[model samples]
Target: MSETLSGQATSTISAVVGRADVLIVGGGLSGAMLAAQLLRLPGRRRILIVEPRAELGRGEAYSATELGHTLNGNAARMSVDPDNADDLTQWLEAFIAKGGWPESDQQHVPVSELFPPRGIFGLYVQQRLAEAREQGAVSGSTAEHVCGEAVDLHIDSSGARLTLADGQCLEGAYAVLATGMFPAARTRQKHSSGLNAAAIDPWDVAAMSRLDPQGTVLIIGSGLTMVDAVVSLEQAGHRGPIRVFSRHGLLPHVRRQPPAWEDFLAADQSIRSPRQLLREVRRQCAAALASGIDWQAPLDTVRAHIGRLWSQASDVQRRQFVRHVRPWWESHHHRSPPLSAELVERLYKEGRLTIEAASLKGLDEPRDGRVSISIRPRGESRARTVTGEALINSTGIEYDWRRVDRPLPQQLLARGLIRPGPLALGIAADPGGAVVDAEGDVSTRLFAMGPPLRGMWWESTAVTDVASQAKALAVRLAQLMDSQKGRG
Candidate 1:
């Protein structure tokens, strides 16, 4: 083992600890894609990925064991490679040609347009990682997967020291935080007297299965997560009336294969505020509709420029946007797959599903194994009660790091190693994904990517954005490593 000091910091050396040139803290899609991209670089570097799960590349979103859960986007747009946008489509073609997937499961959609199950996508990611590893082996680069959870990180001038849940320590010259989506934080109950056990996790299919099949079910939030919950119930032979409640009661619109439109905002430097941007977008949508084109085409054009617009907006403008326009924007922009939307519509038409615009008041603890919920309907002064056999919280991923209950985040915050990003949405990081420390210094040895970058880029969670970030970060890290090697 060797140790070197840079500036005021000194790195301790321990010969027994595992070591790698680059260490990734999460083995989800973000970390796996980064590792894959790094392996393609022309250097022989040791890479270590620390993930508690037995499988890599399948995080909370894509690791769904339920068949009803599917990708929100089509195959053509979900490629892990930014340059090769149709790579997933090509992969799906090959997958379908092999005839291993059931014909009925295809849902009669074209291979390029199919929204495959999340589990299948997870497998594709794993396969890509494996291929990258094999290719790296021929070039002398090596990648190792460590099945462990990274609990804490200690950094010095030379590098970082990562402590795992299993009492193992790993040393690396560089560390990347690729931890993906966090679980939804518990909603603040108005009255906490007896509502402790009244809530159920939206993703817990097993808990959902235990509910009375014919009893009423209450789902909070009418987004994609709530759609997933409803699908799970349907797949489990549930015939109950489902009630979905949200502030806007806005369900995600169905995705369409719209033709590409001219990106008017791409060259417009004057659009900074949310109101200006929204106005321009509406005008473009109106023009597109007049021309017999889908409004989604113009929306897609706007989506391409969201990051730039967001970065240019002032903090106050951003807050205003979040408060006044985020809900409508999210519902229209981040849409559900066609099949999922069809399922939801069919259920609503059959009177099995009801969407309500309301604010949850509180839950009156379980009574006779059922819970009574208080809700105030939109434009109403009086609150009404609804009883359900089960209540599922589908409010979506928690963005505030301060509210996250994870040990790693808690430790990082307590030690002043990291600070919350804009609006406390996620961790603060530069555009290159290098994490900014509490002292406001950007760390060369520490970096981050994926969902943690939501504060930096509003569109960071999708596969396209993530894959592009991973590729760019990999190139940056590889160049940095090469420079250090030359100095050594």
Candidate 2:
């Protein structure tokens, strides 16, 4: 059964959704944006979007219903249009004028700076996709959302084929792996750490409400997801102690509007090594601070250059960066929203929340009806036990394709259709988003975008990244389709 956040999908009741010119494996934001881009282009191709959810746009990130669960970045930075940065700002203004998001006024910020709730953002994506559909209708192009989870994929000379969880089968001239990020709290990994099974989902606010309000809550990881878990706990009326554990215990910095800084990386082409880049960034940040500018201004300029630097870096350099710099990079780069940061700060000030630098060693039997775990401190060899009324795993996104225990990933790996990306971050793919097989051969019929290309582009999961990729990949697919037609 295909279920949406609101209800079940109403129209799809078939085991076979038929053939199309293009088959998108996942129908989240990546798939929806890709479909939207394709629909707007001049074409007469039939497209099939295979997804389990009834809704077309609300992926894992934007499906939150809580008011407290908001986007980390403001509207200005989260637009889905690659060419038009103000697309979301304009849409939000019109949406507000239509009497939507009545509570948005409480944010007391400009439309561009407002951190809209994820649910509202999902609606905006759906509306944009609706417009794309209307435009596509004028042409002979069309797309359908097949509400089913894709289990396995097969590629042959004729076409690419997909098998759904509910026994549905689909075919297309070519397929794209728009499979989005897999969050660690909810996904199944090959290595059974037993931590996820012992903990509650970080986003499930309803489950949090059942816990004792005054009991201590133990959390793992201190990144943006940990911030979200705190918001969930607070909204669920939990007021007791909150203890967070991670290797670095680095809390994300609060995102703020900063003045534009010079693009140091762009101007200085020699900044390729991680050490050199870090030193230059420090110098730039120091200069910014001395000039009374926000330090994040310098850091923001580095965002555009990550793909170039990462892709060109040697594997040894990449390892050095990951080993020594990853923690600080994540904490500074993936910042939390101001409101969420304020809540976390207030709780810390009140002595209600604490952070510890440690790593999970093992899970133990429940003690005194409380969840228990063993953790070793950063510089210590002794393992210590920590217990809580409830536990949450907020370790953030899992990018290692081999660790993901899903059927599709496993099948793809076994069939040599895909390979682990650089440093095993995500599946390896070529520059144009074509899937690179186990034998290092580029796939002609299968392509990838969004998080699946993390190895190729270090920052592939962001909104702007996905939008740019969607537009480019859509054009590539269209050209491929035209060539195939000519051959036929």
Candidate 3:
């Protein structure tokens, strides 16, 4: 096994290569939005999106079948256009008005509310692409959606080469890596038992919903996913008690009714280190508490500048920040929907929900039907056991793409086509999302964005932030493709 980030290649590169003006590697929200933005370009550029999944926009976040899985952020904040403040709302309203649904401009909506399902969100995004095509956004420009996984990328002087899992290859002047969250870590306890099945990843909602409603369901993590699961279970008429366990045992804070102090983090200088940044944030948090402003206000400020702050930090500083402050920061910034918050509170008040701060020891499968889970306290040597019918590991996604079990990233690293960022944040790429080579050089064609750049740009996950990146990347890729065609 290669211990280093980059390694020598023993395998031969693929020979059956095709070409395109632009090749987007993932068809999730970021990739689709980038494709939409590309349609706005003047010339006809053949755009190809390599998405292994059959559906687009229904990434891990929007792919849930549960109607109770509402967006944590407001609909107004999820617009593809950062410039257009009411893009999603306008679209949603038009859609709702056409469907003759009740119209209210309320900020927060419940998970039970009959708004657009995530699959519908996928349809809306795909429809936008179709509308763009009909409007001559890319006149005579062909847009192909190939259902395949891009396993390897080959960067050269001419362009970048993409190797699909089926041995089909695609070459493009530019590429976007928008692979969202990967599957979470599977529990070691489940490895031995053949009967007890559980979902450790957010994307595996079907498996999660299979748990008995009368039996106790244990959620391994307490964050957005936990809250989402609670809403889903309740909607499914799951009257059983829900138990959530984590190190901190703190649920995510909720979004306020009216957004307050939108410009709190607009500081004079954006070059502060992580320590200084945390100090300043605490100061603002204290001030917000004193001034009757919600703590989320000042936290949002820090989030806005997280990219700049992360970029400015040294490798050591970034590692320290991740080790010491990431969880607390995430709990504050990535909040739950107000409705979900209320549901969790209601569950707790009714004794249907219990939060624990003990360390999970292991899983014990008894001769009986139930599964007993062992847990030990932080400071105690004694381990206590709880028997539950099911366990759901809502411990979020594996953010580190290098650790991803897929073959493409591994092949790319072997070929020196891409390198990871400092502090293993994500794949190393230039500011424009161009993939950097192993020799510490930016490739002319290969690019990446979304959570893959979390190391470089810490705040790229939210729709508000990613939309800008997508727009900018699309504009640049369009220009690059046009320039290449002009030369050809």
Candidate 1 lDDT, tens digit per residue, 54-144? 7889988788877668888889889998889889888878886777456525477777788888888898898899899888888888777
| Arranged by lDDT, best first | 2, 1, 3
What tens-digit string does per-residue lDDT give for candidate 3 at 8-38? 2212222222577778888888887887778
lDDT for every model? 0.83, 0.90, 0.70
Model 1 lDDT, full chain set: 0.83
Assess candidate 2 and give its TM-score to the true structure.
Answer: 0.96
User: Judged by lDDT relative to the true structure, which candidate is superior, 1 or 2?
Assistant: 2
Please report how far candidate 3 places residue 259 from its true position, in Å: 4.3
Candidate 2: tens digits of C-alpha lDDT, residues 1-488:
12121124223433335578999988889999999999999978778888887788889988889878999899999999999999999999999999999999987889999999999999999999989988998897787887778889999988898877866577888999998998889987767577788889998889999999999999999998899999999999999999999998789999999999999898999889999999999999999999999999999999999999999999999999899888989999999999999999999999999999999988899998999999999999999999999999999888998889899998999999999999998899888899999999999999999998887878899888999999999999999988988898
TM-score of each model, paired residue for residue = 0.93, 0.96, 0.86
Q: TM-score of predicted model 3?
A: 0.86
RMSD of each: 5.0, 2.5, 6.5
- Show where candidate 2 strays beyond 4 Å: 1-16
